[model samples]
Target: MPIKSIKVRLGLLSIIVLTGTMKTLGQANDTLLIRQLAPVTVSATRLEINEKRLPAALTVLGGGRIQIGQPQLSLFESLGGVAGLFAQNPDNFSQDLRISIRGFGARAAFGIRGIRLVIDGIPESTPDGQADVDNLDMGAMRRLEVMRGPSSGLFGNAAGGILNFQTENANEMSLLEGQVTVGSYGLRSYRFKTGVQKKKFQYVFIATRNQSEGYRALSHMESTILNLKLRYDFDSLTRISILANYGNSPVADDPGGLTLQQATENRRQAHPNNMRFLAGESVAQGRVGITFEKTMGKHLIFARAFGTKRDFANYLAFQAAGAGTINRTFAGASFQYQFSQKFDLIGYRFRLGMDVESQGDTRRRFDNLIGERGKLTFDQLESFKNIAAYVTQELTYQKVTMLVGLRSDAIRLHATDYFLTDGDQSGKRQFSRLNPSVGISLEASSKVNIYTNLGTSFETPTMSELSNNPTGTGGFNPDLNPQQAVNYEIGAKTYFSQRLRTDVALFDVEVKDELVPYQITGQAGRVFYRNAGRSRRQGVELSLNAVLAKGLTLFSNYTYSDFRYREYQTTTGKFDGNVLPGIPKHAAQAELRYFTPVGIFAIAQVRHASLLYADDANAVTANGYTVVNLRVGGQKTWGRMHIEPFIGVNNLLDAAYFQNVQINASANRYFEPSQGRFWFGGVKVGIK
Candidate 1:
């Protein structure tokens, strides 16, 4: 479909919706009151506190909204309405997904960087700030808390912001549920969940399997996930909890990017080299974690420990080193104590904590002979260690709150080479820093909050970024230094009435030595990192939720990002004042949903983005596009069973665009065409 036609249709539909329903209340008054009165949050301060009192830009997505008539295939589906956040690459399972918050993580070449990912208090990202969520099962997630802007003062390294995912705990009522779904591109999924509760014990188990013959050629993917959680309540003041998870992805093909001419010819065709070499990845990962919490008198104590292991193998076309195999082991622990006191009308809370984590990887690279390994090319052992201590204080004085925090971290990297035929190259590096932040929040009224914060953050290059140097070095790149930045932000969350609510935020960030990647000559798939002199980032975000009519709700979010380099010079040319690559300057998303008394529900969503640059030079551009999607579903209750049937159509207007782009890609191949219009339908059965 033409861009103009898509826009006109969407504009017409939106006008019709706005005119048809504009006189109804949002959720029940009681439910709204309960949610607004004392909603709790833990990600901002690392402790439970009222959401209105947190001096930071935070948003929470409840489970009900996340899973309502959704495919649950990627986080993009759940977080599309969040302001200042962008999720991409949902169709390319080989690379998982790309997430950028306020343009902080837009420089990533592969995997996640410059952000922290936490699940149930366990870090999914490595110490060096690299994360992959291919194994994450969205079915069991209960809630997500997103902390925007800089947060390293409390969370240590790579804390540009935090993505915290909380899992559902076993409830007092025993329950069992199962679901099966089939979708376009031969997609299929099955999931099962069960929970049990007793006097002193509770347990929950979840399992999921997903497979797809992807929309594009040579893009098949299959994965299985399992999770188990157990809790024992020794007493009212003490509790012990344990969690275990395992994931396996035997195959996830990499279709590779296509040039403009190629994409124009056939959007569904795979790169010729990718198909000839059978480029793909295979992965297995497992983790176990335990937590103990207790309260004694006026003091509270918390302790946690965790261990994880991963095995990964991948084949790439035209590889310099060869096929690769990586075995990684990671372990971490944390301890914290909190004290609270009250005097007259003032309340005080003091928290002190420490975290320690270590990771080691045994990496082997071999020459690629088409789809098979030809010979051993490189072998190395790489390790990273991090230790940090932090303290936070909160003061509450009648309708106002103040938060201050300080942290110190030490990180070390080590590498050992075993390929003696080349040379015995061993190297080590150490980095340490101290960060602090302060913020204040004011409750202007019963339904309004104003908050502001200032903080410092530092991010070190991940091992992959440091190891692959264009100069063909075997060890870490000594030229690359950690990036540092300072952030300033102000925001407000206001409820106009039971019918409407909104969140608005403005942020400014100044960065020094920003890490940037450049493609190496003759290495078609290789990239190297260098530090830019300085950079500036500023943005505004707004999100709204409103009730248009009795059973109709409207949600919309918009972001305006003005990000560029203040001083940067490359061998090719100067890039000062050029827009950052891979991020759009203007983006907006809107959705309208309706519910009926008979349990029928329908939703329509529209997403739009402005043009974006493909490289630091600003020579290549990817045009903006608009996409529309629609879904309808209903539930029916039987004597002992409940059934829900749903159907979804994506890209209803058949917009032609790229779902993912390779930033600064070599050879002018950058676009990864998005899947065209597709349809999916499924039914779920369970006891209600």
Candidate 2:
């Protein structure tokens, strides 16, 4: 069938389905309009407040929204409709996944940078502002929140923005659940979850195993995850909580990028060199955290501590001078207290907090001889430490609320080389800064809110970015500097009708000493960074959610970005006013959902992006494309057990496009072909 005809048929089908739904269920406005009152949030300012009253560009995804497409494997599945955020590379497990908020994290080669990730109120991002989301157990998550724009004044290092994930907790009941899923390309998954809640103690536990044969050659993966949460109530006013998580991935294969010619010839085939080198990675990680809270009269006090350990090994397609083994440890603690008081018809609140973190890595490199370690080539120890103190005040008068915050951070980084045959190389560097922010929100009406804010943020280079510098000796790059930016933003949220909600934001950002990465010649898996002089970023984001009829809902979001380099001089030439690579000029997402009283649901979605450059010089580019997806499921109950089944189809249009790209890559090998049309189905059983 022709692509155009398919698109037309899909549109007609949507209209027909919606019409039938309205006719069957009629206009049930009262039921559809029944929503939770004043959803509470903490990511915007680290204080629990109504989301509508927060002065920031924020998005929240609950389990209902995230579980629409069952058996979730990647964050991209649910977050595609969030404006100003981009998530890709779901199939490339070797590089984990790529996520950028307003173009801040686009330059990362592996893991995530320039963004803060918090899980269950504990920082997952390291002291140097780097994190890997691949090991997170999505099955254990209950909600996620995203705060876009500069936020260094609130958080600490690399606070370009914030991403927080909260796990499921025990309620006032006990329950057990299990799920099994099978899909195309040998995909299989099994999960078990349980929760118990009592007067004095409560607990939640989940475990999962996943394996995939992959859509492309040499891209298979297998992993297991476990998550546990425990809470004890000392009294009505005091409590303690503990959390533990572990993940192990015995194998995650890497297919490597393909040149344009290779992609055109055979998109399914892996790079020829990958099979010989056995390119892949193995990882194991564990984490634990504890939290204590107490409330005394009008004051609240809280404290938290966490620690993590990780072991990693990898084999690259090309042989160089390293062993691919790494051992890392991270520890952190935070303390805070707040008091609220009112005077002369005005209410005020003040909070004081401190945070400290330390991280260390023991990295080793060895020669690769046909997928096996040959000879030890390098050994080193690298560490980063950070300390920060902050204070915030909030004042409320009438229908307006005002907030101000100030924070100071001190960072220290050091490196030690143990392979002294090439001469001992040791170095250290220190950085310090003060960040400030101010914001105000006005309640335009009962259902409308207007907000704006001004803030400053900073992002430091990750350890990987400071390694193997081209212009300096091999310790830490002395020439590299932190990127600083100032942001001005305005936004509004309104409910035009009982069933319609919309949010819109506009922002202008100015950045200095931006860090940019370039691939070195003849280096297959190595990357270096340099500080570009200046840049400007401006954009608009809009989102909408509406209940069109009794059982049908509509959701849509759009982002328009205008980002450019003000001054940049590269080794090849001077390229000024060039469009930033890796971000689309325009991107959009739309979805239609149908739900019935019989526990049946269906969703149809569309995602589109405009053209994007692949290099800083704008010499190469990737064409824009659109894709469609569909999901359907139903549930049945018997006695105390419930059974559910689901099916999904991805890339229904069978569009051929690139799913991931290596920006500014050498040898012109940039494209990672997307998986074609695929289907999956699964069944689940639970008891409550």
What is candidate 1's lDDT per residue for 357-441, written digit by digit as tens?
A: 9989988888777878878877889999999999999999999999999999999999898877877776898999899999999
Give stretches of model 2 more than 4 Å off. 1-39, 172-174, 471-473
Per-prediction backbone clash count = 0, 4
Tens-digit lDDT string for candidate 2 (367-388): 7786899887767789999999
Residue pairs with colliding backbones in model 1 are none
Q: What is candidate 1's local distance difference test score? A: 0.83
Model 2: lDDT of residue 451: 98
Residue 371 Cα positional deviation in candidate 1, in Å, after optimal superposition: 1.6
Candidate 1 weakest lDDT stretch, 10 residues: 21-30
